[model samples]
Target: MNVSNLLKYCALSMAIGIAIVPNANAITPDDQLVIGMSMDNLLSLDPAAASGLDVVGVNSNLYDMLIELAPKDPSQISPAVAQSWTISDDGTRITFKLRDDVTFHSGNKLTAQDVAWSLQRVLKLNLALASTWKTYGFTADNVDQVVQAIDDYTLEITLPEITDPKLVLYTLGSSPSAFIVDRKEALKHEVDGDLAHTWLTTNVAGSGPFQLQNWRAKDRVLMNRFDDYWREPSEMKRIVMRHMTESQSLRLMLQRGDIDVAMGMSIPDIEALKQDSHIRTEANTRGTLYYVAVSMKDPKFANKKVREAVRYLIDYQGINESIMPNYGVLHQRPVKSGLPATLPGPGYALNVEKAKTLLAEAGYPEGFQTSIRVLSQLPFINIATNVQSTLAQAGINAEIITGTGNQVYGAMRERNFEMLVGRGGGGIEPHPHSSLRSLVYNPDNSDEAKLTNFQGWRTAFYSPDINSIIDTALLEKDAKKQIKMYQDVQNLYDTQIGAIFPISQMVDTVLIRSDVKHYEGHQAATTRLREVTKER
Candidate 1:
């Protein structure tokens, strides 16, 4: 069945609910983490080409980057493949000294050359997520000259003086594009000199803790523990992730102990399971933000006053406390709180009378009717449906359009939709400038501009002043000065209504057996399996 039909079928069955089975497979193997999750598809296994949570959730098990965030704490950065590094006094050059003792799963010793090759591959192949690195001036055409393996154990890269050194490091620390792929092994599998791009999609070539055992698309994935892992191997000897999206199905699987962990559980299911003593639920306040974007291209939303009115039409508190309890927090800032460049969110709440007055001033005295496209998934469907009812109170009737994320986001990217209730931001980087640049601050809004770095381009929202402020904030090396610039941008965000932010940053929750340990959630939903252990 398609997403719509599948969800309907799942909902109907959910009403009947599954009974507690006798053999709830309660005793998971002491050496496995069988995770249950939701995904439309796992497009590619090549880390460079991967974008969604499906791939990111477990890629780290097979790859190691030069630097990475602490699995338990995103606020701090930790060395991975690189033991130590130093930056030039001018902050334009960085040199990393690698760990010679590490070896890839292929039995090939890790080398600095592999690092250079991987970085260049991302730019040359122009992978799906290359834009994240483009912001720091590293491109395929100029990479050889910019990134060099100074020796067998040292790697070096230089940035344009105008680029922020921190931004470059941040991108590298974020994903596998900056990781070391076994060049010798990768080249052997290369077809048509594709840098093994075609081969690696279904293979593993790294020094991380796990190896890709098998992958049957639309069905399941199996990763086996690497005995020769450079670091201490995880207690999990195998990880089995079945392709399951229905929240009810996932909850049932967890309750039956058919799976050790259940991700993407709906709020109602989570609350209901709270009474089940055998299961554990954790809600982590992540950096992800959920919001509604009003297309500036639409004449109805072109007025700033009308956009501002849209913010007050919905009950932020009611939704967080009732509809989204533990799922999301009431955050009104464009950049979520605690990240660099954020300010405490202030007074934007449900004021239906005020919203009606603003609508009248904008010449929509009788209010207006609009439509929003959303994914056929939890939180979004519920959030949009609730917002629709709230908006009607202000005389603005919003019709909810339910579909896959591809359909909804695709429409936003083409500027083909008037509004969208979607969830996305620079939640992974934990930086204010990253969120602001990705969500707002569009200076060049033309077809020729091709600014995928700015989502505002998708919404047709342009603000040159805020754009300049964002650029300024990014370049400031002084932490204090940079944060102040972000605050200034947030102030503009609230006044200009550039985008409507409903929740500060939402969290990801998972239901697991109580014996599972160290299964913390990350903002990107990129859960690392290496550190996870199970109690006897």
Candidate 2:
């Protein structure tokens, strides 16, 4: 597709409007306790349709799922609406024992039927939220069937095959895979034939600790504590998320005590803020992989040797030091550390001579020129510029094309660019099988299917042999066996996959007001607002 066509599609996709104000004066009353955030951009407010971190952070407070990750430690799955769960001997079936006391914000009692309906809705919305499934190789199709309530508190789910350990982890944790919504209320505002799935784009009804009170689109989103929430009530009565896109303005707000919390501040600015006595800094290794996706559809990147050479040209250590200093760590596997079995092994090593020779063999002895698309966010832009410098040393002339996060994604979907620098957030799953499948697996003629060919960069297409291995990995019940199977898939990605240039895991530095208490971080780039309470 051409640039004009791509732009037209982007305009259509984002009809919601960009009402963000970067330098607005402090508007919230001092008694209300407002939090300021420097956001990348919110793509959608609908929980099922949300794909970005900013959108997820906001929606997480609005929606509750059947199962939730423990706030203090993400490795364990804790009860939310469900009191407990059970698995079949073959691991093909999962039975959830629900909590009878929980109720949606609308006051309807939570039921087993609601859980079944919610899973079905998630499957239908998977197409629109393909990126959410990339890390776990999960799709709506994995759910072979759903069995309704044996009683008001019990629900059962059966898979077509034995599910892998990572797939199980994803099923229990990923927001897109497990978040539960109210079926009865969602169906009242149905878009197409599916009410639960359709109504989610603009509306929500959940049993979480907080409930969505109002949304002013790009301007602000307000959520209030759920008085009858299933869990203990939050200390804060209301959470007001104001959209700010400028780092300088956010820094000023943090300094002036206008916001209790600030997100996405620049690295240098965060360091400077740490010196202040009133502010406290918290950082965590968010399981995210930042990399470049080169369009393999382009003839220049069609060769395996050429792609491998590009990987060698990148200085992972230098990029981490210069661009991410305190907020990033070089990643050896696509899977981030702190998760299970993500130990370092041989992948790409920096070798300038190898890159030079490979370029020469590809008929670009003096190097060829290409443009890489990047988001306006500081970390992404810095990485892209650093890549340009690295590639230049290997005789390749590369230019950076900067745009909004949505704009850059739009260009990537249309295959209108040669390369794009971006980050792919990992799910709680400890394997790369899901991540690889999402990026490479083709499902009908969907955009995900089209993009799955890695923009046509794979030296050799995904074969039946690889496909069968992935299918087997998904079914393996043993934890050790599952990890072994995933390692096999990672071997294939490290040797032959197209589009991705694996780099590093994300470490986000968050600044919070010293008075804020009970802050708990998530593996994804989020924190539980329900746990936070300000000192009087």
Candidate 3:
């Protein structure tokens, strides 16, 4: 577990397709930040296509967004490339004045044109991240008109719909699709008029603090500091992010001082790390929620009484206490905690006898059989097993189906599942509408509508009243009234017994060496490494 021994393991891990560094004197160098994490989902460097937190962390460093969520307070916004901005009284347009000193890593001066093009490309390409923009009534065909560069330093965005402009601002600040790319440099590598989409998948073009040296999929990512960065230069000359998925191995590496930071570790390993004098563990609660969802497409779940019975069947307190130690905290409300509009937990507890009685009342004296789809991971698989045991108590024969995120959530997205234990609902923006829109806003319910992005639609759980309330709450300019409207929505959902029942709000934990300074994790997952340093 020594530094030299850990380096040898690193060399072996990189033997396949990664370049081996020679004469590596130190594992945790003062001027280099070494991170250990699972890069399985770090599939693309392309901002338009990247989907997970892994990519968000990488892109946040390699690219610049107009604005960023304040590191200390995610609810507040801070300036990045756009130093100043103004919103119209009508709440339809926003004008941004780009900072004059920024320049892309490629030496081209960063301008508002690049910003406009970057946002437009996301919609035109219509990739994974484009859905966020599409929700704001932006379309591929009209993106150029919607997002226009007024001049070299000025950009204007006109919303097609009457929505809260704060949501759009939050999207610009946090969404991966909002990262500004060097338009000229990207177009230089274009293939078949793709706007360098294919090239960007593996490479980067931005004016951020770090420049990607090389990225070996599922291996490691190497980034060198950009000395010409507009802001204070990054203290670390280089960042080496090694793809280590095993929690014990990461624990060993950290214990030996081989890695400066370790993320996505198991709860047991995380607990063990808490006892280490040289390592510190930090948990930042995110906006996303973990919930048990039932597809109303299933006749059994379509019944409100059955839905209520299923709610009573869940041991929310038990699961949150035993299984969700480092993963999440108890949160029953649909909207995430810490928001003005958010309501208190409804305190739904396990009532097996009541669930059984309700099952009988729902015309099922004998509990029916169903399958629970869940991701084959620590907390998810564990939650599903617990749910299975509880469901059996009420004579419900529940089979646990485990698979990868794609296999499990894809079934939910296609509305092809009976029941599912999943984690989602966009909470990154710190806006109440962000979570509500993703979790419960089902604008359309027809099978042909195919609004797969919304979990409400995916579960075939459509409530016109809930949808109308959400819409009104978003547009409610009066702050106090908006808060009241959101609370009312939660109350209505409680009485209606919605298909998706939230169990906990997610909390992401990371273990860093005690000497690592200024390395705060962002709740939005866009943790910038520019200010990070290590004390030798």
Spell out the clash pairs found in candidate 3.
none
Residue-wise lDDT of candidate 3 within 1-536, one digit each (tens)?
Answer: 56766576677335423334443423566788889887765778898878767899999999999999886577698888999899999999999998999999999999999999999998878766776676788988999998999999999999988898889998888888889999999999999989899999999999999999999987889999999999999999988898877788888767766678998788899998899888998899998899999999999999999999999999999999999999999999889999988998888999999999999999998999999999766678889999999999998999999875567877887799999998887857878888888888888888776666778888988899998998888888899999999999999989988989999999999999998999999888899999997776
Model 2's number of clashes is 5
* lDDT tens digits, residue span 67-161, model 1: 88754567577888999999899888999999988898889999999999888888778755666666676677898999999998999999844
lDDT of 3 at 126: 74
Ranking by TM-score: 3, 1, 2
Candidates 1 and 3 compared: the better one by TM-score is 3
Runs in model 1 deviating more than 4 A are 1-21, 182-204, 339-341, 366-369, 477-479
Worst 10 contiguous positions by lDDT, candidate 2:
451-460
Tens digit per residue, CA lDDT, model 2, 1-536: 35653453234223322222333333333234455564455765565556667777776777767677665466567777778888777765678898889788888887888777776565555544533433333455554254456788898766544455335545456555356777777777775675455456656777777887776655666777888876788877878777665666666666655567777778778889989887888887766668877876678876777787788888787887778855678875655566454556565667899899988887888888898889877688888988888889888889889987667876766656787887764544445554545444332334345332232212123445556666776666687887787677667667674557767777776777777777766766445678777764
In model 1, what is the error at residue 145, expressed in angstroms? 1.8
In terms of lDDT, which candidate is stronger, 2 or 3?
3
- Please provide TM-scores, in order, for all candidate models, with all chains considered together: 0.87, 0.84, 0.91
lDDT-sorted candidate list, best first? 3, 1, 2
Among all candidates shown, the one with the greatest lDDT: 3
